[model samples]
Target: MSKQVVFHIGGWSSCGFYSKASNVLASLSILFPSRLKVVDHKYGSRDEYRSWLIGTSGSGFRDTFGISKASNQTSSPFAWIESSDGGNSFVGGCDDTLAWCKDFCAPKEEGGEEKAVHVDDGHTKGHGYDYDLVVIGGGSGGMAASKEAAKFGAKVAVLDFVKPSPAGSTWGLGGTCVNVGCIPKKLMHNAALIGEILSSDTEPFGFTAPQALEKGHSWEKMREAVQNHIRGLNFNYRVTLREKEVTYLNKLGKFVDAHTLSLTDKKGKVSQITSSRFIIATGGRPSPLNCEGGELAISSDDIFSLEQNPGKTLCVGASYIALECAGFLAGIGVDTEVAVRSILLRGFDREIADKIGAHMEDHGVKFRKGVVPAKLEKNGEGKIEVTFSDGTKDVYDTVFAAIGRSADTGKLGVENINLKVNERNGKIPTKFEQTSVPNVYAIGDVMEGCPELTPVAIQAGRHLARRLFDGSTTPMDYKNICTTVFTPMEFGTVGYNEEDAKEKFGCGSYEVYHSSFNPLEWSLSEHRGKHPAFAKVIVNKDTDAVLGIHYLGPHAGEVTQGFGVAMKKGVTYNDLLDTVGIHPTSAEVLTDLTVSKSSGKSADAKGC
Candidate 1:
């Protein structure tokens, strides 16, 4: 009797997991006369493909392959692939695993160098699955997991619905963070700042900008440039996936049954696929606010595609997104207004948030506090009319809804798999991102635990892959996870805030050491008063342990990253003081701050 075999094909890539997968497939093909085929799934189609693969049940091949479901799954090493054009090719996954298996396999078309090698190992004893383990999702985590498992002689396959990272995209192969989120966003932010400095303050520095300033930092050009760079990343990622021999599938995957997933393409075709183990790093989308007339508002996704700044724009919410976009608009001379309820940035020092607000207002942005839109509608001219709770109204050309974002777990069919979710947001719960379902797990933004920062997501995904497939099961440590808001004067923080520490310790006696100064860059410039730097170190009075480090100034993001590490390592206030300060740098203020014998210590007469 002919046995039906299931392959967990993911996007094209030639890296870690992909390489191991190739070896597993080659060994399996030698063990059984089966032809491995690749499948593609596109968008704008009907139901995705349905494979013969089971969603929840094991196959007769599982016992023969000697594979069993993980009994105590917590966290595991994993990587996955992603591709466009329905799996015609793939890219991005795990570069490390592919590097490890570089010498083992050659491309099928570049064959004739080595004949198929047979394996005499015990790996060929699973019953339900013709192969032992079938890994799903071809993102960085998925690819890494599958490849490592394969190296250990476990059968693995990765699946992805989107296009793989461009060729040689080592980081981009992982997903959005490398492709669209962190890197690109920072680059754009930097470019916008440059535009501001050149246009706004060139004269004060005895340098004159070009006769005619450019309009609003050419959003279309930046978008096109970033997209091209992303395409290159996609290419590099694909090459890595393919070289590793991980099966590439370009289709949207959803739970068809417990152990199986159904993949659909844009053309409505479908394939049923199954895996003994799975990892979900689908990430999150910007949350939507159900404000009246909010239909006219745009989310972060829309902001990415903008070609030009709107004539008049209003940014709603108080998260980093709102502050950053508002800063950009104001910097580029757009008529921008920030409308927020309560104080902005709930996690930062209240004083710092207020200063940032004042800085932005001074830079030409209009701030309206304690008021939000009761309803949003377009007037006869198609302009947005925002009616506030106080019955006052204002019109604008655009409104950005930056309230917040939740995990993108709705279509994941978590309910079908008995995955436990947090009661507050229906988000899948995990100590290290392991869901209730034994074989399935989640990380990154999709998994609810840590702050939703891009680096954190990438780190989580990378660590997950290592533990599951590479025999390293280290849990994520978020004790001092550093984060920043990309406003003009950047704000960054790590570790516990004063209120949290006080509550946890049952004492509100922590010492707050802070310093404020005018940065040297503004020394010779007339804009000295326009930009000020601030730093705060919250220390435990009893232990002198640095509980938190927060900063509002230039290069705050870069500076706070290192500070976060110190805080995580239980660095004390003396450790901060002993560290050699960078000469004449804004960050030096952090280490240079003198702790006061009392609370709320003031700086020198110059505020430095």
Candidate 2:
């Protein structure tokens, strides 16, 4: 007797109609003859048939039907199906059964499964894009966002490319902080400190090395060591991206549309890719002086990688970058001079800023205050001839410009979208890191009104990724961020300055407690009595809560970090007094502060 098989195209369900399956079965029947075997298996759903075909087998139906055995078997229950016509068939597992059936029934010209339509309610299931998220620029902000989005199972990619400076200075991955800004700058600062210690702090401890002062420092050795450490960080960043399964592309990206980006590599080869979301974190670069022959002046980007020693250098501008460069240069035995446009550290607390400037000046750094460069000319002696606006002139072996930095958003093609960017400065105006475009966002120094520090960018980027993928709604808090300036005497501060605090809480509404003491280490140096370490705490008179804390001394960053946490927790003046003091430490001076500015008392620390 010839066996007959009634096979459903999809799976058969007793309660549901299978009209499409019936049509497909009718067509199959016309193509086959009586030799076909038909069996009526009442599989309730597609999952049931899939389980029977591929799952562990002990089914009596396999024995009753006496169907041909599978040609191959292994650890998996599913194996190749053998056909009598010398053809082989393969069935997918349960999760792919619906897709397999759709492909089997549809015509080849009609494509496979139908495209899924998604409703845009701020999120779409299975949204169609080349990637779930694409971040432009491999800086601190972009890298943080990429890694964070990947944690939520997002298909993330980051494209970063560094444009060489006019001085031909270019670095690898990890952006400004690792390459040219914080990492290298701090290393150089430490080098200067070591030089100071060797020159002055060795005698009083009874270890007499009189030749140490004359032996001096090696600029080449310091440069090589700092650069080597920076290069290692670049390699580690690449390794981290791979470990996190984030795709990294070394290509410059420009916006083609809201969802598309045009990428260009070093070879000038161009391509395009699309993503459901994009983040801009290109950061910033040092700006050039707006004067003739200004290109001859190197900015902060080239300072750390200079070939030879920067002898008799002249640093222009009164920004932190200017003071930092000059301070290190002077400490390392180079003749350094700074030309200030106006005030030092423009946005910082003026009192602490002047003290830092005074400390540098006392340590052999010259200041040309209230002067701006008019023209820069290369003299016959191959020195930079800097002509001031007031008809004065000076020449130096190297001229360094630290006027300011401009946001790196020029090549981003942000104008192609509806995003609002500052036309003057190229900074994107963002509300909680979200730009005007719904699918695009900006973070880090590239966003207006955001702190230009690396930690700020890192936190903002991670928070943004969590919100986009993990359904989080918490926004980043930008207040009370502790920061340290690596001047000759480091200045660390958090929250409001004394001037701002007084203005905010009325002229006499806040109590300012301050003390000045000499560091213990300084007692062993010849320059002991020249400059004293200072500490100030501002308290709101009404609430007695600490509003601001400032320190200017050795290890200021370490000392202020602890107080920063206290200020964030709303620690009061009495609470600080209640805390026990650590013996003979600069930070202990805070616990002993007893003089307030309102009382007309001298705020000075005596013997230990």
Candidate 3:
């Protein structure tokens, strides 16, 4: 009685014991062989499925369309047709199947041409929401997820706003990585590296003594160049959203309820909006120093864009942020010092962390152990007078509080929705990025236990959007992620550190293969390359699989990125030995790892 019918995804029946919808269609097909149509689900045309009946039971529609009930979205792909207003007659649900057949047999003038109305899903106009998805924070994760959902023909919006730091430092749209975090940090690190290279006595490399660098480098000039590049990235993120047709809201959002958000613009304007789904990628901010006159200190948030030179600076913290800043400051001849309350790089491999500390120390970054700044105040010379926890005192032109960062979820109103957040760090706990509330999700540093890295956030966000909209079954893999610490020596690591490996595999279960090699790049250079590069590989003794890899050398980021890819295959120590090595590369050390730390023989290399 109809032209044709297709079931793209058959719904479940008898608790998934049988494909009930497929049986229903088959029985009907026998009665009307010429009128009914059925095709393999794989062969189903992409565009034609929109008009076809998505055969499903009450709960079946959810699986049929890959829409989870927790999302609270209509459990049908043709939901727009069912909700269409002031339109032609519509048929929905399995009960209406026979009724539609009867209508298809009737005359055209009688309004029975088997016609189906077409509607766009790009905007949830007819659906019950101001937007399909609203993302809080315009950082790497939020922006990546928003653009991906929009690409799948879903309406998406991103909301972001920056609160000025204690020192009145503010930035643009691309969030921490592009603004004050990775981008600026890397640029400044490179600038310091270049200065170190130029000021070096490079007689072996055929470079003459450089008298031009006799005048110390200009911190203002480098800061300006870094800021200019960051500003461009910020503008590009905004333009990307516009090009993708995703709404860009320069407002801060707080939850009013499960689906409602109270939005506040920069000018103190307030409004309310609703969305079917929410993804929080708010990230974190530098914690303010909590001591007397602590406000006098700047943080990584303000250091990249500092107006004046940070002369004779004291970096107060042992975290990577503190070390990186200290490294660069010392490299550029700023006479930098570091004050530590505890161990450096607390969560990293202890051995690697110790080497980095020693390397920085040799490079002129002073360290004051077991002490934190108890008080910071301006002295008569305008330098900050800092009182240590040990009752000692010091003076410095600038004090940088690289203490740590806190997730910016305090005012996010997650409590209103009963979303349990990590009270100490403000990180939201999630399963596959899904929060306690079904329709809400969390990604990036804001999510509890996820790596607080930009690339990790971007990968998680993109994967999350695919699962939400593209019927993808892939979940974000949080394990074995490669990361780097941009200290002066540069440390790159992936998978478990040695301590964690021992804890996971137990003593005598995992053996450590390590080497201390002098790179050809540094073998003859006495001016810059003072420290020999180190490498370590943690292997499961039983399985021979590489449990972890760590590298300390130049371009650690570049060397580690390839390991990240090879790691996906579960590469074993034998597999590494089976492959040939690339000559004179820092990464090749991983493939040639033969000296076990347990052997007690020195892991040092004499030749390249």
Highest lDDT scorer: 2
Candidate 3 per-residue lDDT over residues 364-390, each given as its tens digit: 889999998899999888889999999
lDDT of each residue in 1-608, candidate 2, tens digit only:
33443332334454233433343345555654463322233466656754554445644323233343532321121322335665544432223333333333322222122332212324454778899999998998999999999999999999999999999999999989989998998888888898888777877788776775667778888899989999999999999999999999999999999999999999999999999999999999998989988998999989999978988898999988898889899989999999998899987888899999889999999999889889999999999899998889989999999999889999998889867888888899876688888788888999998988999999999988998888776777777789999998999999889778867768888888998889887976768667899998888785577888889999998999998888766677888999999997889988878889889888777887
Which model, 1 or 2, shows the larger TM-score? 2
Model 1 spans with C-alpha error above 4 angstroms: 1-158, 162-180, 212-216, 243-245, 595-601, 604-608
TM-score of each: 0.72, 0.79, 0.79
lDDT of each: 0.64, 0.80, 0.79
Backbone clash numbers for all candidates listed: 112, 6, 0
- Summarize candidate 1's per-residue lDDT along 159-268 as a digit string, tens digits: 65553221112233545555546666677778767876787668877887865474435666777887678668767666766666556666677876557787786587
Please rank every candidate by TM-score, starting with the best: 2, 3, 1
Error of 2 at 35 (Å): 86
lDDT of 1 at 298: 81
